[model samples]
Target chain A: MKNLLIFGVGLIGGSIALKVKKDAIFDRVIGVSRHNGRSLDDFVKKGMLDEIAVNVEEAISTANFIIIATPVAQTKNILKKIYPYLNADCLVTDVGSTKSEVMLDAAESLGDKFDQFIGSHPIAGSEKHGPDAADEKLFEGKNIIITPHSQANKVQLDCLWGFWECMGGIVSSMTPSQHDEIFSTVSHLPHLLAFALVNLINKKNSKDQLLEFAASGFRDFSRIAASSPEVWRDISLANKKAIISDLTLYKKEIDVLVEFIDNSQEGNLNDYLSKASSTRSEWAEDKK
Target chain B: MKNLLIFGVGLIGGSIALKVKKDAIFDRVIGVSRHNGRSLDDFVKKGMLDEIAVNVEEAISTANFIIIATPVAQTKNILKKIYPYLNADCLVTDVGSTKSEVMLDAAESLGDKFDQFIGSHPIAGSEKHGPDAADEKLFEGKNIIITPHSQANKVQLDCLWGFWECMGGIVSSMTPSQHDEIFSTVSHLPHLLAFALVNLINKKNSKDQLLEFAASGFRDFSRIAASSPEVWRDISLANKKAIISDLTLYKKEIDVLVEFIDNSQEGNLNDYLSKASSTRSEWAEDKK
Candidate 1:
């Protein structure tokens, strides 16, 4: 019987467990908790997992598929623990925001079995976390990116694509570098800006009073600032090079805008804002 | 009979018309369209306005209360137009995002009648616009800030407070400079950042490709970027000093974050993000 062993059954992993059980994709699904297993109890009570694996070695050895659904920082340690016990045909994949770093961690930790691993990022998440926040339909129609290294096993890569597809994700493949660059621009930079915006307000002498008047615009713009500190810290570090590059470019954009406002260049400022506004409006329209 | 004459029957004006009509707050509500009367047509047909003003002079002459809900750039011109015809007791107020500039405009245009004018900024709006997007419940439980000049008539100020309170607004008073400073930090800065971010993406060679993968975090964070160019241009210019100061402060925040990320200051970065995350979390929780 096929076995699916999931590491760190929080929002991402717990959702996967729920979906897998509903679809019966694997004969037995086992979870290994990263925390104190208090989060895992809900999944157990709900019958989302076939078992909570008490023995990591036994679970890894019997598993045909292993999914590492932990923070990027924990991926290397989890990879190291499972590498010795992994069967020859076991396909290992991880759901980490930054792929290049995770790819490096897998290469370092898995050694000879590195080809069996592929990096996946299901671009679906909420400010909320833990198993209690897991939703079975979280990945439905969401973009799930897979970043496979040059030495990745062709058969295992195909299996990884099918695995995400079966979870109702729109799966696409890209190189680890491409994945990191794209996400750094689209995701990492925005998160950093949000955190900084919140921190800027937090630093103000009138912070509490300022926050009291923050309306829907601030609410939506700062929503991502409420994301997990540890998770974002891991992402920020793992993808530092690309993120820093984007941040540098973004700072230049801000400086240009400031110059426009500073000089009272009404026409130039209007044109700049018009371009941004029209582009955003079109993007929002297209989203609908 | 008490008449409420509203200039620019768009989102803000139309919403005010709706609330006033539903509550029968005035004997007659008349609308003065800024554009062609096309947008005002639905409002008249829906019985939200008793009449669309045919003669600007007559409308101004008979009005007991005049609400200028037009864009900030047009406020000077609207005030200039109605100044000659305004009766001595006619209280004039505007719903502009920026207070100091609008206050200046009223001071310039109204001359001896300056005390009759009070600047009001209702801190409630949607990304949507025009009369069709108007809601009677728009001001329900929302903060309505009135920025009254020191020389302002106390009776007119009290009446203005009563007017907004009648429409279900929670009214508060502050000076024009204080209003500009508070909103500069909370609203204007966030908007400028959102616009700049969208423009950054627009400048990228892979704009469409990057936008395709921009998920919820990017979506929510950039939502304010879709605001009206003309409106934001007016706000940015009107509140230039405050906005620029905030932007400079925000840029420093960005620099600090970039330095943390660039040097791989893991502990410092984590602490910075944790503070933002926790502050945002507590604010969100309190909001609920």
Candidate 2:
């Protein structure tokens, strides 16, 4: 009977545990809560977790698999705390937005044991948070990118892939640097722009009336801005270099557009808008 | 029997025709298509329009209510064309995104008959265009702002309000300058940003990969970029002064945010994001 231990279970972690346990994928499941430990009590009350562990070290010896499901910022600290106690052959992985820093930190801190760590990020989330927000089918039909560590054992990497596959995720692999670079614009920059636009509108002289009449467009454009500030703060900082590059690039585009609008250059503005319009219409997206 | 002649019928005018015909708000409905004369035939075939008109002069003499549903850039020309034929008692209004320029042109060109024209913008729209996209209930529970001419008769303004109200629209009033300023930031700026961001992403080093991975966030964030290029081109150009001012203000906001992200200033980023997050949560919006 294999044991699966989940650390800092929130939306991502709790959902994984729920899905795995509901499917009876593992014999024993344990969760160590970092969010006030209140969620662990709820999990126990709800009969989801087989048990709860306060000290990760006490739980490490018995677990064959450890999933760190915390924010990316805490990845290094958590890995450091458990490395001395983790079972030699334990399959360790994480579900964080950024991968390069976490993988680098693991390589530096875990020494020869770096093979045990695999960096994975499931591109499925909503603005909601907390354990209660966890859904058993959260990862169903979603893309999960695993940033494989080169020194990691091949069999352990396969096992991690299988775990995500078993939980209904479509598994793919990419280097940590590639993952960060790709997501920097596709996800992080969009969130930053949304946040910035919302704040700009908020601070405007006509904010009260502006917000009052802000309809579906403003609502949809700024929806991601409603996300947890602390989480985004961590993400922007963790993935700073790539995100800054994206922001810088986007800044240039916006400046050029501003000139077109300012100069009332109709032809240039039309061509600029036509590019975006045609591109958006062509892009494959699941309809809202 | 009141005849409502709608020049430049597409989504906005066609929708008004459909709703008013459905409710029997007017005795006659006529649509002149800017996209094509074919849509007018379709509207008549669908029993939304009582007849189609090719010449605004031929239509204007008979219309008790004349709605200029053309693009903002065409407002001055349309006003010049129809003012010569309009009945003194007729209430002429427009459905354009920008109002100040249209109203100013109305005052300048309509000469002593400026009071016959009212600048109104229904705060309801969709990305879809043309007669096929028309919805009878589009104006239901939506706002329509009338930037009334100061020299306009109170009775004529009330008639204008009643006309929109008859189409199931709630009517309000504002100065043309006030309407332009508010919408420049809320409506025009968002569309500009969406377009610019989409183009920026399109021109990126990883356009294909970025788009393939673009999910719900990108979909919602870039939605307005899918708006009609010609329509937006006209709007941004027509309201150049106000939109440019807003673009500049938003540029400043983006610069400040870039500074934080570049410096990895987590504390300031958190607070800035927190303000937006909290504000969005408080605002009434459709759930993501």
DockQ in order? 0.89, 0.80
Among these predictions, the greatest lDDT belongs to 1
lDDT by residue for model 2 (A112-224), tens: 77889999999888778878899999998888999996787889989999999998998989999989998988888889988888898888878888887777888889888
Docking class of 2: high
* Alpha-carbon shift of residue B154 in model 2 (angstroms): 1.3
List the candidate 1 regions with Cα displacement exceeding 4 Å: A39-42, B35-42
lDDT per residue as tens, model 2, B209-276: 77867777888888888888998898888888888888778878878887988887888999999999
What are the models' TM-scores? 0.98, 0.95
Worst ten-residue run, lDDT, model 1 chain A? A33-42
DockQ, candidate 1, vs. native dimer: 0.89
Candidate 1, B-chain TM: 0.97
TM-score of chain A, every prediction, order shown: 0.97, 0.95
**CA lDDT of B114 in candidate 1?**
89
